[model samples]
Each structure stands twice: as structure tokens, then as C-alpha cells.
Target: MSKTRCLLLAVMAYDRYVAICDPLRYSLVMNRGFCVRLVVGSWMAAVPIQVGQTYQVFTLPFCASHHLHHFFCDVPPLLELACADTFWSRVTLHAVILLFAVLPFSMIVISYVRIIRTVLKMHSAPGRHKAFSTCSSHLTVLTLFYGSATAVYFKHCSRDLADTDKYLALSYTVLTPMFNPVIYSMRNREVRIALRKLLWGK
Candidate 1:
């Protein structure tokens, strides 16, 4: 799921970049075959790492007491159970998060910066408004998703994950997905039209 989402987000950032920055070449750049390959590549890249990470955690010997403080069974919470040395595990975890989260996030930021610059240079007010509206929903989703995940996993100490962090995790897992469609509906004319047609046969 994490791998799929990261890949999707990366593709989305590129889609928006092409759409906003090089509208003339958007179709040529983002054709159907290109998109399919991106999806397949994301799965291939993310699966091996996720499998390896899962195996590493489950193989660790836990102490006599078995309890998890967090709401879910992710890497950080599971590591708290390790009876063995955890320095390398923690380092690997951080590196994975940096690769999946920080790197994609940096690409998104760079794309948006170029997008904003391009939008501002547009001569037509309506064109600029349309461009901003198109990117706003994606930007909001990116912020909510990354902001919560970063707060949860990137902490200096995994043992410090409080109940509040659990709520934040909930927001990351639950609220982000829930609000994605809502944000799109509000900001996206095509989505609203499609929803209306589906619901009311309009």
C-alpha cells in the first residue's frame, strides 16, 4: 500500500508538472503506456523492500512481555518489541522513509514551485485560476498524507509515540483517504459532474 501510494503520488506530481508547465507536450509525455509502466514499476520496487523489512521485524526475538503501544502493527511499534540491538534497524527504517517519503515529497515540491511560477506568468486570469484550482486538491492531499506520516515515523524515539500520535496516524490512514474524494469533488468540475451523473442520472 505504501509503495503503491508513493508511486501514484510521484506520477501525479509529474502529471501536474507536465500539465502546468508544458501543456503543449502533456499528451505526448503522459500517454497510456507510460502510466501503466509507472504503476507496474512502483509495485515491483516497493514489494521487495516491504517484504524484507517485514521479515526482519518478525524474526527478531521479543522479550517475555509482549505488548504494543501504538494503534497499529507498523515497523516502529514492532521494533519496540525487539530484544536485540535496534540501532541498524532504526537506521534502515529512517533510510526507507527518507527514500519513499522525503524523496517523493521533494519532487512534488519542486514540481509545485515550477507550477506556481508558470501559473503566475500566464496572461489570462482565468487560465491562472484554472491552473491553481487543478493543483490545490493534490497539494492539500500531499500535505495531509506526508505531514501525518512524518510525524508518526520520523520521531527521534519510537517509544515516545503517544496516544496523540495514534490519532495522527488515524488521520494519515483514515482521514486522508476520506478527504481525498471530498477535496476533489469540491475543486474538480469533472468529478462533480461524474458524481452527479452517477447519483442523479444527470
Candidate 2:
């Protein structure tokens, strides 16, 4: 699920890139068939890699306590439970992170860089604002999702910081997703104005 989301987000960034950088070609470039292929391709790419990782983790002889420290069967927590030498497991985890998280994130960054350049070149102030506004929600969601994920996955996990990991995991897995709808919905001008009025009586 996480891997799929990352890839999907990358696809969205590409869609936005095409829309902003080459609006004339947007319809043709992001056609219905092409969109379907992108979605399907993301799933196809993520599933096999995830399955292989799951298989590798479960195959490890967990000689220690069967209880997981974290809320779910995450790779880091599962690795902690394994009594065997987890050199390869750790390697696989890093490999998966590089492929799913880092690579997709890099693609998003590149898309946004070009988007920023294109937006800056716009002569009309409203046009610039509209272009930046179009990306604000996506950028916000990306920051929240990737920030917590990076904090948890990229760090060296230790028993002393297990609680910290749980909180970070909760942010990415629960809180970030929970806020996604609200965040995206606020992209609408009416929604934003209403929200401001409700909060500040403006």
C-alpha cells in the first residue's frame, strides 16, 4: 500500500508537470488510457517487490519473543524480533526504501522544480498564483507523508526509541492519511475561504 501510494504520487506529479509545463499537450499526454496504464503500472511494480520482501521477512526464524514492538508488522519491528543475523533483511529493507521511497520522491522533486520554473516565467500575477495554488495541496501532502516516513524508516531503530518510532509511524500511517481528504479539499477557493471564516470569523 505504501509503495503503491508513493508511485501513484509520482504519477500525479508527472500529470501536474504536463498540465503546467505543456498545457496544450495535457489532454493528449494524460489521456484516459494512459492514466489507466500509469495506475496499473504502479501497482504491478510495487506488488511483486512487496511480496518478495514479505516472504523474506516471514521466512526468517524468529527465535525471540513473537510479540511485535510496533503496532503492525512493519519491517523494522519484525527485524527486531528476529534472533538471526539480519544483514540481508536490513539490506533488502534499504533496497526497497531506495526503490519505492527515494526514487519516487526524486521524481516528484524534479517535476516540481520544472513546475516552479514554469510558474515563475508566467507574466500574469493571477496565473502565477493559480499555478502555485494548484500544487500547494500536493506539496503539503507530500511533505507530511514523506517527512514522517523518512524519520521512521531512514533512522537507526533502537529499543530506547521504540516509542518515538511508534509516534512517527502513527503520523505517516494514520494521521497523514486521515488529513489527506481535508488537505486536498482545501484546495478549492470556497473551501479555503469558509475554513478561514470559521477559524477567524473573517
Candidate 3:
């Protein structure tokens, strides 16, 4: 459920970036149908990624002594739990990173760079500030979400994971979601105004 929703949201943001920020086809691209198609594509891609993760968990040689160092049984945590010789497992892990994580991360980076450039290209001070504010919130959430995951892969996993790794995983999975709306919405006057209007029915 979370994976589907997150994938959908990620696609939506990418579509929005293409529609709003692209230099050539900003106006011509991402019609409603295209948006739908993009989101559907994300769902299609995510299903296999999630399934591969599930298959890896059940198939891997996690002995009784092997413990999952995450709140949920994600790919990295399951890999950490393997008790057998992991020579091939590490190779597969990097491949998985390139497939699911690295590719999506590259897409996100491309989208945001285009967005920040678009914002900065604006001339008027207020308009540029507003754009910066809006994109800053989004960038904040992206950094926190991706940064924590990167930490686990680069810092924790590179060093060998332990039960303490779960806290870092929780930061990526749980805390980031809670922080996203606050970081992205609470600082925006228009969003706050809309929320107040919805709340008071005025």
C-alpha cells in the first residue's frame, strides 16, 4: 500500500516538473492522459520491484540467528539478515540498487534540478522568492527521505548492519513521511489559507 502510494506520488511530482519546468515542452507535455499513463507506469514498475524484494526475503539464507535490522522487511534489511556466504548477495544488492533505487533517484534529481533552475530564472524578486519557498520545501523533503536511505546504503550497510540500523531505517520510512507535509505545506501561506478555509467552512 505504501509503496503504491509513494510510487504514485513520485510519478505525479515528476509529471508536474515536466509540465511546469521543462524548457521546450512545458506547455505541450503531460496532458491529463499522459499524467495518468505516467502514474500507471510507476505502479507497473513498482509492483515488480516490490515483488522482487519479497522473493529475495523468502529465498535468502537467513538462519535463525540472522536478525532483521529494520522495522519492516525491506530489501536491505533482509540482505543484512543473510547468514550464508554473501558474495553473490552483495553483487545482487548493488544490481538492485541500480535497478530500483538509483534509477528513481536519478529521475528525482533531474526533475528537481530543472525545477530549481526554472525558479531561479525568474526575474521578479517576490515571484522568485515564492518559487524558491515552494521548491525549497519540496527539496527539503526529498533530501531527508533520500538522504536517510543513502546513509543506510553507503554508511551503515558499507560498515555492516546491526539492530541499531533499524533506527536509521525508521527515519527514512516513518519520520520522513511525518515531516514531509510539515516541511512542504506548513510554511506556505496559500496552503495554510486553504487549510483554514477547509477547516472553518468560510
Candidate 4:
């Protein structure tokens, strides 16, 4: 789920960049077939990293207490219980973080930079407003999702996991999913219009 989120959010950032920076070419660039390919490619991209993370977890022998501070099963908490040396597993986990987290986040940042530059150049107030509105919702979601996730995964391997860390992890895993629809729907005029039409038959 985490890996999938990273890829999809990056795709969304790219979508925004294209929509704002090259509106004329947006349709041709992000067409039906292309969008399908992006989704499928994200799923495929997640597979190897997910498998590696799973493999690292299961191979370790847990000798310490089974209790985990975090609500969900994740590598950081699981590593605490392992009896054997986890140097290599930690290395693998970091690699996964770099691949799945850092790379996607870098892409998102780059896209937003271009998005900001393009949005600023719009001469009309309404044009600028529309451009910012289109990007703001996705940026909000990305910040909330990535901020908490980075806090959890980017810590030093030897650092102790605190209660605050567990809460942050919960925010990432649980709260973010719940917030996504609300953020997108509330911020989007088209979605609200569609919802109103569905409800009132207008």
C-alpha cells in the first residue's frame, strides 16, 4: 500500500505538471491508454520492493517480545524483535526507502517546481487561480502522506521507536487514506457538482 501510494502520487504530480505547464498537450499525453499504463506500471514497480521487504521480515528469527508499538506490521517494528544481526536487512530496507520513497518524492518536488513556474506565468487572475486550485489538492495530499512516511522510514536504524513515531505511522497508514477522498472531493468543483447532481437529480 505504501509503495503503491508513492507511485500513484508521483503520477498525479506529473499529471498536474502536464496539465498546468502544457495544457494543450495534456489530453494526448495522458490519454486513456497512457493512464492505464501508468497505473499498471505503478503496480508492477511495487512488486519487487514489496517482495524484498517481505522476504527480509520472514527470514529473521524473532527472539524478543512479540509486542509492537505500531498499529500495523512494518519493517521498523519487526526489526526490533529479530534475534540475529539485522545489518543487511537494514541496508535492504534503506534501499527500498530510497527506491520507493526518495525517488518518488524527488519526482514530485521537481514536478511541483515546474508547476509553480508555469502557474506564475499565467497573466489572468482566473487562470492562475484555476492552475493553483488544480495543483493544491494534490500537493496537500502529498505533503500529509509523505511527511509522516518520511518521519517513520528515514530515521536511523538504531534509533529507538517512540510512541510519537507510532502515532505518526498511524497517521500515515490510517488517517491519510481516510483524508484522501475528503481532500480531493471537497477541493474539486467538478466532484461537488457531480455529487450534487446525483443527490438532487439536477
Candidate 5:
């Protein structure tokens, strides 16, 4: 699910890039068929890699206690229980993270770089604001999701760090997702006004 989300977010970034950088061709380029294929491709790409990783992790010999330190059956926690050396398992895990997380993140960054350049070139201040506004929610969600995920996964996993990893996992797995709808819905004017009223009682 996380990998699929990353890929879908990449697709969203591309959609925003075309919408902002080439507004004239946005409709033509992001047609329904293309969008469907992008979604399908994301699922197709994520499933096999995830399945393989799960298989690899479970296939390892388990001599330690079955109890997991983390809340879920994550790679880091599972690796801790493996009786084997786990050197190759850790290496493979990092490689998968690079492919699914880092690569998609790089694509998003590239899209935003070009978007910023295009927005800066616009003559109207309102136009610039609007363009940036369109991306603010996505950027916020991406930061929350990617920042915590990277912290948890890319770190050197160890028994001593298990507690810290669990907290970080909560950020991406629970908190980030919990806030996604609220963050994106803030783009709606009525929602913003209602929020102000609820907060300020005015």
C-alpha cells in the first residue's frame, strides 16, 4: 500500500506538472485512458516487489521469539527475529526502498522544480499563488508521508532502536494517513471557512 501510494503520488505530481507547465495540453495529455494506465501500472509494479519482499522475509529461519517489537510485521522488526545473519536481507530491503521510495520521491522533486520555475515566470501574482496553492496540500502530505517513512526505513535497524522505529512508523502509517483527507480538503473554500469558524468561534 505504501509503495502504491508513492507511485500514485508520483502520478499526481506529473499531473500537476502538466497542468501548470503546459496548461494548453493538460486535457489532452492527462486523458482518462492515460490516467487509468498510470494507476494500473502503479499497482502492477508495487505488488510483485512487495510479494517478493514478504516471501524473502518469511522464508528466513526464525530461532528467536515470535513476538515482534514493532506494531506491524515490518521488514526491520522481522529481520530482528531471523536466526540467519540477515546481511543480505538488509541489503535487499534497502534496495527495495531505493526503488519504491527514493526513486518516486526524486520524480516528485523534479516535477516541483520545473513547477516552481514556471510559477516564478508568471506575471500575475494571483496566478503564482494559485499555482502554488494547487500543490501545497500534496507537498504537505508528501512531506509527512515520506519524511517519517524515510526515518524509519533508511535508518540502521537494531534492537535498541525498536521503540523509536515504532513511533516513526505510527507517523507514516497512522498519523500521516489520518491527516491526508483534512489536508487535501483544506483546498475547499467552504471547508477553510468552517475551520476558521470552529477554531475562532467567529
Candidate 6:
């Protein structure tokens, strides 16, 4: 599940970057046909990624039976149970996670930071407010998503890191996605306008 979601997020981040950096060319470059291809590409790439992660998770030859941990069976917690030599798989997964999971997320953050800077530089108040209306919801969602993910990945657990880690993880895992649509729907003028037009026969 995490593996699948990670792939989905990768494609989303890629699309978001293209849209933000070159809105004029985005439709041409990531047209409907190409967008379909990107979705397929994300799945194609996900095969190798999931295979590698699965390999690292179940490869340890001397692991004990008690494999579950922290609400779900993650690769890292399973690796911890392995009494055998998992130095290589551990190192590999660590590298892959940093490269795939962490890297795209960082790109999202950078893109938003760039967006905010650009929006803030607009000349008129209405233009500035309108620009912010497009991005503020996304910014809030990013903060919640990244905040929880970083907490979980960095081993900031409930007992050791803080009692809040569990709730934080749940926030990102369960609530963040749900809240994203809400935040965007309410704060994004375009979305609200569309909704109003749809509901009020405008």
C-alpha cells in the first residue's frame, strides 16, 4: 500500500512541478495522452521499486517470528526483527527511500517555496491575494504531509521521540489526504467558485 502510494505521489509531484514551472507549456508537454503515459510510467517504475523493497523486507535468513510493529508491517520494523545479516538490504532500502521517497517530497517543498516567493512579488493587492488563494491550501497540505512523514521516517517514535509521534503518523497517514480536498475546496477561490456555480445554477 505504501509502495503504491509512493509511486502515485511521485507522478503527482512531477505533474505539479511541470504545471508550476511552465503553465503555458504544461498542457502541451503533459497533455492528456502524455498524462496517461506518466501514470503508466509511474506504475512501471513502481514494479522495480516494490520488488526491491519486498526483497529487502523478506530476505533476512534469521529473523524471528514476531515481525509486526507500529500499527502495520513496514519494511524497517520487519528488518529489525531479523537476527541475520541485513546490513546490505538495510543500506539499500535506506538509500532507495532517501532517493525516491525523500527526494520528490523535497522537490514539492522547493516548488511551493518558489511559488510563494513569486506570488508575493505581484504588484496589486488583489493579484497577490488571488495568487495566494491558489497556493495556500497546497502549502498547508504539504506541511502536514511532510511533517508526519519526516517524524515517522526519522524514528521519532511515540515512546522514544515523543508521545505525539503516533498521532502525527495518523495525521499524515489518514487525515492529510482527507483534509487536502477540504482545504483546497474552502480556501481556493477557483474551487469554491466552481462549487457555487454547480450548486446555485450560476
- For all candidates in order, the CA lDDT equals 0.83, 0.90, 0.67, 0.86, 0.90, 0.67
Estimate the TM-score of every prediction.
0.88, 0.93, 0.74, 0.90, 0.95, 0.73
Per-residue lDDT tens digits of candidate 1, residues 1-202? 2656766787798899999899999899999999889888877888888998998898789985687776778787777778899888988888888888778778878888899999999999999999988888888888888888878776666445577677888888889999988987777678788888999995
After superposition of all CA atoms, the RMSD between model 3 and the true structure is 4.4
Model 6 poorest ten-residue lDDT run: 156-165
Sort order, TM-score high to low: 5, 2, 4, 1, 3, 6
Reference-based lDDT, residue 163, model 5 = 84
Weakest lDDT window of 10 consecutive positions for candidate 2: 150-159
Superior candidate under lDDT, 3 versus 4? 4
Candidate 5, poorest ten consecutive residues by summed lDDT: 153-162
Model 1 misplaced regions, further than 4 Å: 158-161, 190-202
Model 6 — TM-score against the truth?
0.73
Structure candidate 1, residue pairs in collision: none
Cα deviation of 26 in candidate 1 (Å)?
0.9
Best by TM-score: 5
Q: Which tens-of-lDDT digit does each residue in 75-110 have in candidate 6?
A: 656666778887888688778777667776776667
Which stretches in model 3 have alpha-carbon errors above 4 Å?
A: 1-13, 19-28, 156-164, 187-202
Candidates 4 and 6 compared: the better one by TM-score is 4
